[model samples]
Target: MRTDYPYDLAISDLREFLARRVTHSNVLSEFQEELDSSLKRKTVPMRFIFEKFIKYTNEHKQFVPYTKDEEDMIDDLFHFWG
Candidate 1:
């Protein structure tokens, strides 16, 4: 079925619009806390830290999550910054 809005363009626009809305300070603080905990445990895995950051951001809506269809494109463009 045909739709009024263009799907690809809409996803792109939404991603761009939300990019500026993300709160960097909250992300940074969460990352720092994770890093400190990892350091104390003496098992500092960069991947783990990043994964936790992504999960935290997604959960807290610091950066809003995208829909499934938008996942690939958004990930390619922003490396899942959300």
Candidate 2:
């Protein structure tokens, strides 16, 4: 049998693939776009969606290489989230 949650599955799979292809930032942007589109058709809050991405990315960091400079850049961006 096949499944319909391909987007979700892709997100999970890509998290691992990204470990070897950290240079491919487009995949992350595509995932974010799909997530935003899904939320736009429902009652989900933006904050919740943002948190989900943040949490997943953090949890899977072991699979991806995040340099200290990149971490600092993220921290700076997070400061403006308010």
Candidate 3:
């Protein structure tokens, strides 16, 4: 699917983040699930979706929580939209 500016950047950031941490298929699946959920919010900005995604992965424990530096790598990409 075609993606615009910061949304595309956010997806890149997410894919990169998952690339580091995903050791199994289920993790990738869960990431997709969260991404889809965030994407469904047509009214919300990408930055908020990105933040919620980070929170879900951090809190849900299906995937490992991000380290501070790891969070830094992915978190700011969507802020470019604002």
Error of model 1, residue 10, in angstroms: 39
Please give the range of 10 consecutive residues that has the lowest summed lDDT in model 1.
Answer: 1-10
Q: Which predicted model would earn the best TM-score?
A: 3
In angstroms, the error of model 2 at 22 is 7.6
Q: Which stretches of candidate 1 lie over 4 Å from their true place?
A: 1-23, 52-82
Each prediction's RMSD to truth: 12.3, 12.9, 6.6
TM-score of each: 0.33, 0.32, 0.42
Candidate 2 residue 80 Cα shift, in angstroms, is: 1.4
Better of 1 and 3 by lDDT: 3
lDDT of 3 by residue, 14-53 (tens): 6667666655677577666666665565222555545655
Candidate scoring better on TM-score of 1 and 2: 1
- TM-score winner between 2 and 3, please give it: 3
Model 2 score (lDDT): 0.45
lDDT of each: 0.49, 0.45, 0.57
Residues 25-62, model 1: lDDT tens digits: 67555555654565466443345544665676677767
